[model samples]
Target: MVSKALIQEISQLEADFCSALSDPTRLLIIYSLADKPHNVTELTNELDIIQPTISRHLKTLRDRGLVYTVRNGSSITYHLGDKRLTQALDLLRAVMRDRLKHRASLAKETKATINA
Candidate 1:
């Protein structure tokens, strides 16, 4: 059994995870990194975002332990720190799909009722 303090810590960690994903640019970065490791320059070129912005997001991900980096000569390449990140992304996609479908169905029902 988990203590109250442990539960609070877990909740905070979940909040941090969601916070890290709140930015669309950051999400894109994570998805990009999911495919393969990339250096800051490569990521900046691929994302079309400024180097500082990419570095900021990368710092947040690193601080949260969501990504791991290694030095390749003078460049640092980043990769997903956990295999479970893919599973979590898959779960989130499924939930978003279900919610979107539900909203569309509701809108269709509302339109039909108004036309009836």
Candidate 2:
């Protein structure tokens, strides 16, 4: 059985980390950084988002400890805080795909029933 304190910790972490990921643009940024670190300009070009928007999302990610930055001369590059972040995202995507497939099958069954 899980302890109440553990559940509370999980809740706090979810609030901290998952809230940062609530935006699709942020998710795209995460995916973009999975390959390699990038500065704001590079992320803007890669994700086709405006530099300001990318900076805003990056700040959110940085605040959540989801990404870390390194400085090279005047440029600052962001890297994923942990590789497992992408793995977790991939797992969520798989779950979403499974849910959609299930819903499609249910819809097909309902349509067939109506026709019958």
Candidate 3:
């Protein structure tokens, strides 16, 4: 059995992960990092957002232990810290596909009812 403290710790970790994903910009950052690591300037250029905004979101992700940074010369590049992030994204895609299929089925059923 898990100890109460362990459970609480796990809950807190989950909350932190969710918090990191709370912003669409953060999610986009994660997705971008999934392909390749990037410095703040690269992320800003690719995301079409401001550098400070990207840096702010990257800081949040770093605080959550979701991203890691490496210094190359004067620039710091960021990448996903946990490999599980890729798995999590895959699972999310699967769920989205399922939801879309369900919606299509429901729409078909409603159309049938209307025609009947």
Among residues 3 or more apart in sequence or in different chains, the pairs in candidate 1 whose N, CA or C atoms overlap within 3 Å are: none
* TM-score of candidate 3 to 2 decimals: 0.85
Regions of model 1 farther than 4 Å from truth: none
- Per-residue CA lDDT of candidate 1, range 22-113, in tens? 89888898999999999999999999999999999999999999998999999999998887887898899999999999999999999999
What local distance difference test score does each model get? 0.92, 0.93, 0.91
* TM-score result, candidate 2: 0.89
- Can you give the TM-score per candidate against the true fold? 0.91, 0.89, 0.85
lDDT per residue, candidate 3, 1-116, as tens digits?
88999999999989877888779899899999998899999999999999889999999999889999999999999988887887987898799999999999999999999999
Which whole-number lDDT from 0 to 100 does residue 21 have in model 3? Answer: 78
Candidate with top lDDT is 2
| Clash pairs (backbone) in predicted model 2 | none
Query: Whole-model lDDT for model 3 versus the true structure?
Result: 0.91
RMSD for each of the candidates: 1.4, 2.0, 1.9
Error of 3 at 63 (Å): 0.2
**Model 3 RMSD, rounded to 1 decimal:** 1.9
